[model samples]
Target chain A: MTLNPNRAAGATPLVAMKDISISFGGIRAVDHVSIDLHAGEVVGLLGHNGAGKSTLIKCLSGAYRMDSGEILIDGEKAEIHNPRDARRYNIETIYQTLALADNLDAASNLFLGRELVTPLGFVDDSRMEAETRRIMGRLNPNFRKFKVPVAALSGGQRQSVAIARAVYFNARILIMDEPTAALGPQETRMVGELIQELKRQGLGIFLISHDIHDVMDLCDRISVMKNGVLVGSEQVGDVTEDEILGMIILGKKPERAGVN
Target chain B: MSDTAEAHGAARKRSFIETLEIDTRLLGMIGAFIVLCLVFHFQTDGRFLTPRNIFTLAIQTVSVAIMATGMVFVIVTRHIDLSVGSLLALCSAVMGMMQVVVMPQMMGMGFGHPLIAPLAILSGVVVGVLIGAFNGWLIGYLTIPSFIVTLGGLLIWRNVAWYLTSGQTIGPLDPTFQLFGGINGTIGPFWSWVVGGLGTAAALWSLWSARRAKQVHGFRVKPAWAELVMGGLVAAAILGFVAIVNAYEVPAARLRRLFEARGETMPEGYTTGYGLPVSVLVLIAVAIAMTVIAKRTRFGRYIFATGGNPDAAELSGINTRLLTVKIFALLGGLCALSAVVASARLTNHANDIGTLDELRVIAAAVIGGTALSGGMGTIYGAILGAIIMQSLQSGMAMVGVDAPFQNIVVGSVLVLAVLIDIIYRKRTGGFK
Candidate 1:
């Protein structure tokens, strides 16, 4: 993939994944997919199951290594072979399953791989709990169960933990896979507001969702994929909800929204 | 929830148990252990609780107890090590050869050399680490199941030990090495109280500092009274154990023999206590070190995290495969250490050394409150579990129970322990 003309004209997108191709055995899970996001923008990746959206996003998140692809952050090629590498580039993920170690407390889950260590190299647990308490107090003031395992937490509380983990580490580019899929309507609205807040703080987000309505309401642009290929990318203002749905289902771009 | 407001309310409202923050499951395990001890004491007509009997039990428990600590880590990571006993035998055989045969006879170094003990220990531990790494590689990189890998290891290593020693006992090890076995070696009464005193001080210091640290961070701390009570109880336990072990007097005949060896005439009416066995000290060091690694280190956190949800751990940037290798390797090192104590205690390494120790070690860990399902276990619990297992066997033997019947009873106790643990955890809403 060539460099975007927009990069030469002005600012680089916060993240640019170009020509990502990955395969399992002989089957191609993601085929030559390219996607990008810019600062302060919410890019919704919409597709049905087996449309390779998750696979494509996993490559960017460093959960899966793309067979042939380059990921650029702020116009520089970033080599992320594992989640640790992705983290170093300020890329964080909230997986569809929330991906918290259920046996560990919320503070342990939050710090996780990068724990707050003491001067003598032991895990600084109390400090971590205090930090978790401080952050949760800001993010979800009602959060009081800091000592219990995340398995005992409610759906919204768990979601907030996943989000807080990303936010605490100062994520510049966030990959959220079905962040509200398991939450109630009220919790869903709360997540919608959280996404807005992240966007307001100029953090680029890639929201992978099956809901066309969520894309229409919260996304700045929509990238639809089908059968391991991208149909097209369109601005939310240009494409109606029906057009986006057609693109997801039929894997074809509606002509009206193709111009701009 | 400002500083004084929260602390004052919690201090006034919380019960003693709540303030201590002790695990209910751990308390239950300890309660069971104590009950078992009491039953054994009664059944054996009080012989089981005698100072001499308890001291002997401590030495007998050391080898398996040390191995059980490692088993806790293995089980916590959702793995089982059926090879530990065989590994111990192999380690013992290797060390025996190093000190008695290989270095002294073949390498032309005299036996009982100071270097012989250290060199033997190093060789044994290295061999264990290599084998453990091999097992871990099969499990982690090759994706072989741990149970199958270790089961195969159980057979392969036992025969390998036989091959190493030609199915003969390797013995008359270096004298320095024998000290590790608690065979005619002990710290005596004076140093025992010193260790107990230092341990008491450290325990109290940790409790105080932890409370202060919490307060400094504006986090909730236990009440002043609760902290004092906790400290007092810990200190008392430490000193009490030291006192019991120290009460076992050294025999007059053995004291006379010791004086003759040192080229001195025995004094009339002289008596002394065998304060602490070296083997027991080794086990204690292992317990403390293992506890620290489990509670305060990154490796330990990754272990629980991976055991909890492997996908989550991997996504969190932990190299779980490597972690597996490291864990098995650590257990292997512990196995070698246990071998040192076992063979040394025997005054020689026999072909049948550590035979069936696998079942005993696993039982100890399980009884000690280690969850077979993973993401849970405690070093202290496993040590106490080892004590309970040993006490059962010793108490039965004291009562003149048949050896076969003793096995039947111990086997039944293992199953009952697991069952009770499951029901307790389920009722308490603990992590299953």
Candidate 2:
């Protein structure tokens, strides 16, 4: 596998979290860690369980507050006190749970927080459905169950709703936690195609996953974390699967790799 | 290729079955209501379908139906209010006292004044809202489970009613106040027909606009014939109701016969028509308003969303706790309105008024298709559920069914409705 040669050549980092730290109870869940994502790039976050990768991403998604850290978006300091704050910065997170209201139809769930309303303060459901259809045409052309509750949908289609929600809201930075974790091979490939399409549209994505093959196939760069600490980050072409595995289990960088 | 063709045919049949199953529960409820009416119509020797009996049944349904509409909201938000009956009683007691005792004394009027009835009803509603707000505050802000809070309220509020009236019935309410709940307080036949015509127009307009909007958005819509069929059904239902009431005229001959039976001479030119009862009109207005709130408003969407998934709703920037409070408060206001209707109908207020009514209200909502576990319900369904419940009671009584047997039947129906709902959910892939 080879990385795109121009992956990180001249793009400015769109989001940077410096020395982020957080603790649960008396234990440090995430030790001092720093990571940056450039515009139009897909950065894969790989880690074993309890490695604090999710917790670290949670801080950026505004699901958790870091004990000590500063986050910069587009080189400006950003204070994200909650999920709404993260949304204001055009950052949307698709949690592993998908965070969808199961009883609502696709258009309703897509506009759950920010509904389209007529001048009379009535929910403009027709307009919302039309918009959902337009966006789904681009993201998942096969989607057709617009009126059924999302709970009746397949996992892949539900993921499409979640993705469409984030993307339709003009999100520039996306944090997708295990986007392909519960999908079949076909669905995983579908998500992979979606990620590639999103990348082409110049959105920076932080994809947290344990699937190394997925990381290699879709990510421009891979960052591995172990025990709440950064083991290493390398351009995908700069290392092989064995070296990435060694870094994950042994908590050491490959000797031949150039530091990213 | 033959196998593929067979599979396609089977798939189409299966999809058709699925759509039928999806709609059958509501259709079943409607069918059950019609069957019940038919059986009772035969059992009563045609008296059950008489306009007078039907009008009386509608009036009896108003109080329960009004509360059932509110119960849909309460239950949709994943909460239960067992205190509604007691709340109604207490509000009735307060309103009765204000009209019969407090207002007269304060104004120094020897007889009840015209303004006293309206003032008393307003106070009753205010008291209802206050109690509802308190319940909401505890359940929403204090994070107490609604079941425990409202259960505690059931005991406390009923006792408060008993204490307020000192176990005595307050009686002989103001004549004008009694009109709000009386049979003669109905809109006349002419006005009833006018109202029915207007309602038919509104229904057709709404259907046309919805179809037009869907088409404008380039979405799939029902055929024009389907819309026309629906509009025709609504018009028939409304106009039929008006026709029934208009047919209930008290002929001068029947009046003379009654006067002779009572050993009195008949008066000249005595006549009457039942028209539409004022209480039924109140119920209809409440149903329409609640339907709008449940279908169109942001608050209504929030209620469903909160009931569907509290965590997701919270993360989506919904102030779920505040929404919970608002829903409970709305329930309270409805309880007050119900109290007014109940007290007016009786021309009196008693300690036992509205006792066991909470059960009936809850039963009506559940029967109508509001999920007890929440997140799915409709106002029209609740009203129909109320109708079914009252029909069962009235029909059984007319057929000389014992009181205990009536309870047994109603309880079994409630359980059956919920069981059907569960089966429906399972068929639909289990509660989303």
Candidate 3:
């Protein structure tokens, strides 16, 4: 199925990844996929494992380079060669594996690359810890073991630290890959509220998930991919949960969802 | 440290040491050190702790200890530089050639020209840094494993050193350079006390300012008395070391020779002590500078972070490849610095200078609690590790133990220290 590759008439998308394709070892992990996100919107990217959902999002997150594609940020071409470049565009990612330095403390992990520094150019560890505490206080008030390395924390605690790192950074565009895979149900709800909060703050988020209910609950639009191809992109109200699942499972296009 | 201890503190009522916020691991190491000293003192008929012997040990540890400080970071990053001993020899040879052969022949600058020693030192350091950068480039850019690259360096640099000197010893170095060797240059008792006072002041001020910073940040601060007591303990340690070193008096015969050389008469009962050797002072400065780098600087942070998780560090925007080059380059500079102290101490550069020193440095860093797997080390720990290694060897020698037997004991001690460190980390729930 040919997905529509058009921009809104007047409003520019906060991020538009156009015609992205990449391969590894003669296998097309992501092939000619295009997606866009607007401010104050949550775009759910749904697929099974090895369905190219992750590979496609990784291009915009700067974890992978597309074979041929260009990323436009707010209608301007953006050059994202690395995670550092992606960060410069105020883009932050919370990977499925969390991508945290396990041996460092919560504050150190949060400020790993861009540390808060004193006037004398030393890492202002105290200020960072305080800020971490302030943010965690709002995210998870029970997070008292701030001083230990994340390696020592429980699964849920570690999840919050990863979440707090992304949330505290004030990212204009956020990418989350299976963020709730390690989180408890309560924590999952907390993240749902966080997504809502970030949405009202006018940030664009790309939430990659397999849970249809979660997508329907949190996302405004859903993009489903199968075998390195985008099968459909549909509004939450315009589609039912089963139709979205069919697109995810059988690579059904949006037009066929209406016919069936 | 405050890192994990605060969480432990919150869990239950704290112990005395925990309340004081002292690292239990460091305290345990210190305890072991003192115990080792006491046993040696008994075996050596009290000779081990005598002022003269203690002073000698301090000077002897300087060369290896300086290199060990750099080795901590190297090991912390899970890389090994097996060429340090060879690098030290090469640096010493370069400095020697600069002083005895190159300076007079090329620059036409004869001995006692002042530029000879300074220029020679600079040349040695440049060679070290350049070679270090080359090694780093191979490991970081060429994607060669550090172990293989440095292992090759161990053999290559040693041969290079031999070729530079043509298997000969260069001697009768610039007289001023010998001062760093300890006997020729000693800051007298007065200056030692002054330095001690300044060190105490710095320690106190640092402690106070840290407390102030904590208060400003609204984090949990330690009790005021705990800070005061810790400060007092550090001050006492610095002052005590100075006092012990100051107790070693210049022999009357040597004093008389000095007076005669100056054409000055020696007065009766006019005695003075060699308070601290300049080499030891240099090690202290290196320790301070390395600690500051490890704790305060972004470069140091990236190193540990990379060691902890290279993927995470890379994703966090750290240029880890460039950092590797810088780390090795820093280590090479330190090796050159060690060469300076070593060659100065020998009063010449020798064929076997710095032989087997790479093992000693790696042993020191590992003993100091730098995990070989990567991502955990401390500068002070490495220095203490060097000290412990030196003390064990020297004490065994004083008790008439054979050289091979001394090596066996030191080797066993290194293994035992790492075993203990691993168990402690496992028990304490530290990073796996």
Off by over 4 Å in 3: A1-9, A256-260, B1-11
Model 2 earns a TM-score of 0.90
* Residue-wise C-alpha lDDT for candidate 1, range A129-228, written one tens digit per residue: 9999999988888787787788877889999998999999999999999999999998898889999999888899999999877878888888999989
What is residue B35's positional error in candidate 2, in angstroms? 0.9
Backbone Cα, N, C clashes tallied per candidate: 0, 0, 0
Q: Assess the local accuracy of residue B430 in candidate 3 as a C-alpha lDDT between 0 and 100.
A: 79
lDDT of each: 0.88, 0.86, 0.88
Q: Report lDDT (Cα) of residue B404, candidate 3.
A: 94
Off by over 4 Å in 1: A1-10, B1-13
Q: List the residue pairs that clash in candidate 2.
A: none
Q: Which ten residues in a row have the lowest lDDT in candidate 3 chain B?
A: B1-10
Q: How far off is residue B309 in model 2, in Å?
A: 2.6
* lDDT pick, better of 2 and 3: 3
Q: What residue pairs clash in candidate 3, if any at all?
A: none
Q: What's the candidate order when arranged by decreasing TM-score?
A: 3, 1, 2
